[model samples]
Target chain A: MAVASAVAYRPPRLARKRTRQAVLVWCFLAPSLAIFLLYRIIPLLWNVVLSFADWAPLRTIRWAGLDQYEEMLHDDVFWEALWNTLLFIASAPVGIVIALGLALLVSSEIRGRDVYRTIIFISYPLMTVAVAIIWRWLFDERVGLINYVARSLHLVDRPIQFLNSFVWALPSVIVANIWQMLGFYMIILLTGLQNIPPNLYEAAAIDGANARRRFWRITLPLLKPSLFLCIVIGMLNSFTSFDLVYVMTGGGPGRATELLVTYIYKLGFSQTRFDYAAAVTIVFFALLVAIAWMANRLSGGNAGAVETD
Target chain B: MHRYPRWPIHLVLVGVSFLMLIPFYWVLKTSVTGENIFAYPPSILPKSPHPFYYVDVWYYIPFARYFANSVAVSMIAVIANVVLNAMAGYALTRDFPAKAFVLLLFLSCMMVPFQATIIPAYLITGRLGLLDSYLGLALPQFSTIVCIFVFKASFDAVPRSLIDAARIDGLAEWRIVWKVMLPLAKGAIATNVILAFIWSWNNFLWPLIVTRSADMQTLPLGLARFLSYQEDTTGALYAFCIMVLAPGILLFLLAQKEFIRGLTSGATKG
Candidate 1:
């Protein structure tokens, strides 16, 4: 009986050790988990609930089922903003294509490639507000560099009001957005380029494939993951570029430059319509999740940085 | 391999680089020269460049106060990121119950962009009584999911034998993290520090939403306000832009390798 009791005690001690480890792991994870819970998980759930209610900071709360969404359906500004958001996203591939070209160029064996890469990448890390300011001045009609050059070259007889014109506001803003994000796309593609095994290119060469053929066959196929990443990131950027739009044109001359994010901001804080803003938030969130899901599926379920396992 | 002439590539790259950098150069030229936008044939070079505009920006609109606010908030964010992310990352390396659930939670949290959460985030901050404070500005960014994974990747690379040796030596789990794991994860530390500082320093929306008082506004807010108030009439605003951009540029130039590495690793593993 004593021997049996000793063996039983050994099993209990093992269980205690396992429990101690589990406790330690939880302790280690607590602070970060707490932060995400408060800021991310809670806010997300709150946004969903808030979307279904008529609530503000100081007002009585009431159930307003589908009212905000109904209003959004009829709102021209909302439709315009949504359309502009899609346009902004549509413009992403333009930047990605340019970035891919830059990536291919920079990755080639050339003198001063690193310097060129650094200079190109330098713009990305600066504050977006400052970038917007710089671009705003550059597009200034009176003394802007772009106008100065355009006039000197006789591209236009008169200075164009790039940010103030309804026709040019969206495109001008898109150019600024692309300039800021170009370096980031280049870097991502550069990393992807580096990761491709050189032997494939060598084998293609041995098969008499031309440079263009090699790119179309091997480089393009292998670069799909990076391209998908750029696309998703580009979509995310268009959604979050509130500072740029707010500072550059304030979503004007009218609603031409208004994005969904800027609209949500105006509704919530500027107009104090938190309930309506919550609805917009839900729609925007849904759009992002759907885009992410589609990217995951399109990338064959291995979209970088998104896997849940 | 066919060796192509490099000059065309260099020429193309140089042209691209010029396009990328002309904005900074133009801004700098304006800031220093204070040239009037109305002037015909703007001087190709900054004629008689002076430091007066920079001085003007310094005294113009509580620049020092905004600078201090940015620094303090960024410091809190950077410290919290390193500590919290390291602990969380180290914990992830060990097998435990519900580990998969936790990873899934973090991944989903990453999808919730901060822009999408501003409404509730603001209300939550108000409830916590942190609104109009530095903590509110820094709290949302305290533990970036990407940085957590950065630490995880780095710690996962540390040989298991070393951790086992520490365990056999009777070192507690937390001590092993502090003494053994951190020492071997210097690159990850650099990545976290630079990324955290950049994100916190450049954060505009949160500061704009959270701070009601003028004194609590950050550099980005200050620059934006200065732009709205003065419009493009003054070089001081351009000077302010340069002042706001300097730290981030300097940090990037100083540790660009680590910065790029951090971004690439995060993106690839993300």
Candidate 2:
């Protein structure tokens, strides 16, 4: 009805050219709209439907109602994964703080800012599979760099199994994730920092404010938007924690690092329980929607913070 | 010479940079040396550089096949992202009824994570008989909301006079977009291409679900299989890592400034 109202009052004389322009517009929009429908919107709706149905390899699909959600409630692994997913969300600020620190440093004129920026930002572009592979090697028990340094410094009698230990698995992956992501946050934050009006800082300095005072009084308040953007983007990124968790531990050492997406993969593909996984997907989808709604509020209705590559 | 003390800042930045480059240096060093990678007191430097592992990785596994698949998929994704996204973006820029609705649709699509969409995406791809096909792997990635916005932002930047002048000269709407606008938006296009390449090449989950045959696996999937199957061999894994990671890194390096500008413009303009 709203759309009908929008195009209803096309004046008859200008209708032809308007129609021409409209045809051209849709001609351009066809491919993307089709993709959006087929790949995104349809799949999302299908996920919602599939959650309420059960699938068996040889047997026919049957309506399971909330059976899958019931199973999810009883599953201990599901609870653990839920906990780990929250942990992953909580881990966002670790990377953000580090990135803010690095961004603050690099945004200033110390020296070799370009080199620092390039090297720091390099990891963001590398494949997580490769980075995870390297980190695996680094965290190896025997001659891995972490072990080597620990042993040399007499910090331990043995190399800690960083990826293998349940206690350390999430933290280890979190460290690698932060290492990979800090640069991206730094770059984003650096841009935000550069956008701050210099006069604000200049006036603060001229009024006998110290460097610390200037940062708190001038920089911190202004930098809140960028910081908030990083927080939300980082949390959104934490949702798709499949690749690193897969390569690093395979969500392993007994499902210690199992993120929800990884658990969904395990259920759907590994166990052939698509219905249960679909339920998990729906639940998480709702959670993310709530988070995205909050992100909209945080960004003051500019929700582009959630729309990243 | 700076206002703040330079020494402390330089020291901190250099230290952090080194920490950041640790994984790259370790991978490169291990792949080259072929020495006891797990030996205690890990060699800080390569004693004997052995580049043969790169060759060994190819013969041991079908690295060439995976590399080729990745290349083809990434290239197709890049081209499609550039062209189709630019079209949708251009269309959104026009003063048409329901423009806000269409734009909202795109943004909402962006919010839906692929984890939710993967099950049905697999089903649809299976229905199309595209499972294990390159087109199937590359198809869903063709258009992203980010790319559309990039192009729209670029199109918005093209001065109204330039587009109007092209209109006066009898160019069609798309021709105006193509001839008058796209050239000016090469920075956006380049960023889109690089980002699309990285996303496609690094994508492991969808391919893992879609691909059954070993030969059809992309490089990331292949490396993962190697890590799981040949868990003892570190050198070949490093070699594969170096090979798979280099292209994306080099592409980013080549287009660093444009990429940063494109990113920040989307960021600030938002």
Candidate 3:
């Protein structure tokens, strides 16, 4: 009887202890989970639902069923914004290339490399809005430094209206974007460069691999994960660059710089087109997920930079 | 190892660094010298720099109020991030049911960039009646996935024997995290604090959407409004920009090692 009683006691107590741990782990997780659910997951699902309904603040939401997407089909601004966003994504490789060069330079044994890295990275951590302001002034048409230098050096006939011109506005914003992002890319690539086994280069040297051949064969392939990471970040920047475009040009001078994010903001807050904005949001989210998926595939099914598991 | 001349590398890096730094120099030059857009031949150096423009910025707007608002919001975010992320990260280190699912959830949440969620985030914040308030401004950024991972990496590096010893001493799970774990996770905590502070400080859009009242505006919004209001007429706008950027730059300069580590933590681990 005593043995049976002890056995009975042991199972329940063990089960209770397991239950207690599960509860404790969950309790620890509760706050962060609550915040993410409220801010990220719920809002994401709600955005999807809102896209399908004609709703505004304080108005009853009514199901519209593909109407918003249909409107998006004909909306020229939507197309332009989408095109501009893709252009931004396309420009990512340009920044990455330059950053790669900078990374290689700094990663080598050189004087004042840390200082150079610090100076290059300083611009990145500045407020984007403030950076926009600074760039706007730099690109100012009349007394702008760029114009002054151009006029002095005979680079152009007149001060180019960088932010005001349709052709120049998008590229100008892209330049600013690249400038701010270059440091971050360099750092990531620098880390990648540092991780490469020196013995691989040594092996290549013994094989009579020239510097260029060694770089092409050894350095580039090993840097795939980091390169892919930069590409992903660059893609993500298109959506996240709202503040830069918003403050610099406000998607103005004929929507030349109108990114999807700025367009969505304008539609929802400025124009009170919540339903349509939600639709754009869904499309934007889908684009990002697609990019991530493609990036994952491109990295041979393990996007190490973004690996979840 | 092959040796190469260093001058060319220095030359190129110096030129690139100059390009990277020119904008900041230009802004600082304008702010102090009160150079307007019409200042021709754009002086290579400041003719006369002064602090009056900063004073003008201070007087032109409610700079103090905006500064206070920014500090409060960043404080809430940094403190909450360090505490909550430490707990969540500690929880992640332990074996538990659905651990994989939780991590996947966190990863997916990261992909849902905050910019894409603005419309509904605003609506939800409105529902919670937190708009135009400090909590509303800081709520969305209270916990970030990367910082959580930073804490996890730091905690994972802590020796398992120490935790076991703590457990043997009859320490509770929370107590283990507090007494045994946190003492060793100072680097992660610093990373979290700096990253959280910078993100909260530099945030523009959320505050733009959430804050309706002028008084509720943060430094970024204030600087934006000031830009529009003044339109670069005086040096005050640039002064405001400098003032707005100073804290972030200062913090970055002070703790750049940790800042860079926090950013590159996940990338390097992979």
Candidate 4:
């Protein structure tokens, strides 16, 4: 009877150990996972659910399936917002180009590269909104530094209203966006550059390939993964850019700078049209997924292009 | 290529970096100019740099309080995020029932841009009555998928033998993680903490939505409202803008090495 009791006690101890492991794992994951679900995932799911229902704070709720979607189809503001979003996202290529340029320039065996890298990379960690405000000052109509420098050098005839005027606002935002992002993609591309063995570049040089040709062949092919990542992330960031545009322009000059996210914020928060806002978010989600997929597809094949071209 | 001096590369990079600093310089100049911003031609360099604007910004807007709030929220959030993320990441890499599924869930969450969920998040916070509190501001940021992803890779590089030895000695799973894994992953932990700190400090949207009162405002939001209230670039207010960004810039300078590493290393790895 004593032996039986001891054997039973050993099984319970094993069970106790397993239970302890399970509890420990959950404790480790709970804080982050709970916050993630409460803030991010729950909101995401609720956003979808909210798309089908009409509700406002301090009012009765009614579920109207697909009505919000139907309204969005004919909403001119929606289309205008979509156009503005495309305009902003068009800045992605500029980011890629600047990133590529920085990557190429810094990859060279040069003095002070680390200092340059640090300076540019410094901007990446700073608040984007702060960066935007600084850009706003630089683009101020009367006393902006850009105008002072350009006009002093006889580059332009007038002090452009970079933030207010229609012609300059989009481009101004795009340029600022590019400036803020250039270092980020550059760092990523530099990493990719580092991963490429020096022997390959050496072998290409031995084959009598010139600098431009070698870059096109060797560097471009090797750097495709990072380039692809930069492009995808750039696209997403541009598509969803809020802070810079919010502070610099406020989608101003009569909604000229309104992107999808800004538009959604206005619809839901300012106007209290929760249902319609949810619809806009759903569409933006689809656009993001599609664009991401397309980018992946295009980037995947570029490796082949790198070889063939 | 050799025709262009290597100096040109340095010249261009240094030149661009100078361009980057121009706005920061302007912030300093404007804040101290002690003149109305609406003057016909704004002075590029303030004739006199006054320290009074910083004082004025602080007095007029509860700048000190908001600065404290921002610091408290960000520091707590960063510490919590680093610790929790490292543990979850270590476990996911080491022991779990459905490891791949859990990781994939996190990855997909990463892809779900915050724009898609800000409203519902706002609602949930409101429901929980967490609005206008530091916990409200910091809690959402505490669960960053990026940190988890970075820490997981760092922990993967830890030797399995450490865990095995600890188990042989009958150290519990939690202690093995706390004692064995954490000391070894210091670089990654520092990277995550600093990155999280910067992000939390710089965050605008969550704080904007959740914290309604000026008393509850973080530094960035407070500075923004102060700027908007000024409506034009006055010398003193401009100085305030520069002052607002000083801490962040200083932190960046101090941890520039980790900042660059975190930014570059995380992007490529994931």
Candidate 1 lDDT, tens digit per residue, B54-144?
A: 9998778999999999999999999998899988988888899899999999988888899999999999999999999999899998898
DockQ of 2: 0.66
lDDT of 4 at A247: 85
- Candidate 3: chain B TM-score equals 0.97
- lDDT of every model, 2 decimals: 0.91, 0.84, 0.90, 0.79
Chain A only: give the TM-score of model 1. 0.94
Clashing pairs in 4: B30-B235, B30-B239, B31-B238, B31-B239
Count of clashes, each model: 3, 1, 0, 4
Model 2, residue pairs in steric clash: B32-B50
Please provide, for model 2 over A209-252, each residue's C-alpha lDDT reduced to its tens digit, 9 standing for 90 to 100: 98888888888777777777677778888988789999999898
**Per-residue lDDT tens digits of candidate 3, residues B41-115?**
777888877889889987899999999999999999899988889989988888888999999999889889998
lDDT for predicted candidate 4 compared with the true structure: 0.79
What is the fnat value (0 to 1) for candidate 3?
A: 0.81
Question: Considering summed lDDT, which 10 consecutive residues are worst modelled in model 1 chain A?
Answer: A300-309
DockQ of each: 0.74, 0.66, 0.77, 0.51
What candidate 1 gets wrong by more than 4 Å, as runs, is A1-11, A306-309
lDDT of 2 by residue, B1-270 (tens): 145568888998889988988878887988987575656576888987978988889888988888888888888888888889899888878888888788778878878887778878888898899999889999999899878888887788789998889999999876887788989988888888877877898898999999999878999899899988878465877888888888888888998887776656545754
**Candidate 3, lDDT over the whole model:** 0.90
